[model samples]
Target: MTRTLEWQVRVGLSEEDGTTRAEAVLDTGSEKLIGHGVARCNPQDVDVPVIGDELAASRAMKDVAAQLMKAADHELETVGAGPASGPVAPPYAWSDTTA
Candidate 1:
């Protein structure tokens, strides 16, 4: 069965008092999910707005990913497939190889 599905995700970022906050929202037609993240700069560290935005956005996306995984696992269980054997692994595993 060939099926086509499209999901839309929107991310917004804001900064206040040296802190950056990000909100990511995913719309899957039938449902919507939202994830939030925040990044704060240390007083001794250099101030870089772009860096904070990057960090906050990445974290928010990570939150969304985790939510999606949980939803998938629950759906599988609902279908009698049972929950995953264990925690779902991230797309990439950390490696010690020096580039």
Candidate 2:
């Protein structure tokens, strides 16, 4: 079965200090999840700050992945019931965009 997902992202920055903020939203039609992050100063700046938008987006997707993995594992374990060992296969697999 194939699942469809919809997502959105927004980034903002502070004019004075160049602080950056990012927000991401993930929705699966039936459910929704959100992630927010911030970055301050420039990477080349003396203080050196983390890049918020990238961090936020990446982390958010990571969280979603974790959740999906856990759910898949649980389902597989339940269905197997007598799993004796060996590698637990992922319920689903996806590949990154290739050009």
Candidate 3:
């Protein structure tokens, strides 16, 4: 099949006291999902706004990636595929090179 698909993502962040909260949205052509994450500045650590944003944003993006995986798996079951064999692992899921 020849098809073109695109999705839009937006992230927002807020800071209060020593806490930073981030929210991310994924807007697929037919679906919308939201994810949230929070970061805190250590009491004895220097406050860096950019650092907080980066940490919180990373967590939020991870949260949304999980949602996308879950949605795709749910749809795959209806594509004439046999029942899954136990739990399925995502392509190239986290791996460690430890013996």
The TM-score leader among the candidates is 3
TM-scores of the candidates in the order shown: 0.81, 0.44, 0.82
Better model by TM-score: candidate 1 vs candidate 3: 3
Better of 1 and 3 by lDDT: 1
- Each model's backbone clash number: 0, 0, 0
- Ranking, lDDT, top scorer first: 1, 3, 2
Cα deviation at 30, candidate 1, in Å, is 0.9
The residue-by-residue lDDT of candidate 1 on 1-99, one tens digit each, is: 999999999999999999999999999999988999999999999999999999999999889988998888799888978644776555568965789
lDDT per residue for candidate 3 within 1-99, as digits (tens), equals 999888999999999998999999999977888999899999999999899999998899989999888777776876746346576755776675666
Worst 10 residues of 1 by lDDT: 82-91
In model 2, the runs with Cα more than 4 Å from the true position are 1-23, 33-51, 81-99
lDDT of 2 by residue, 1-99 (tens): 997765543333332356655555656566555555555665576643345545545655666566656665677788987355778655467655577
**Local accuracy by lDDT, each model:** 0.90, 0.56, 0.88
How far residue 28's Cα lies from its native spot in candidate 1, in Å, is 0.8
Candidate 3 residue-wise lDDT at 99:
65
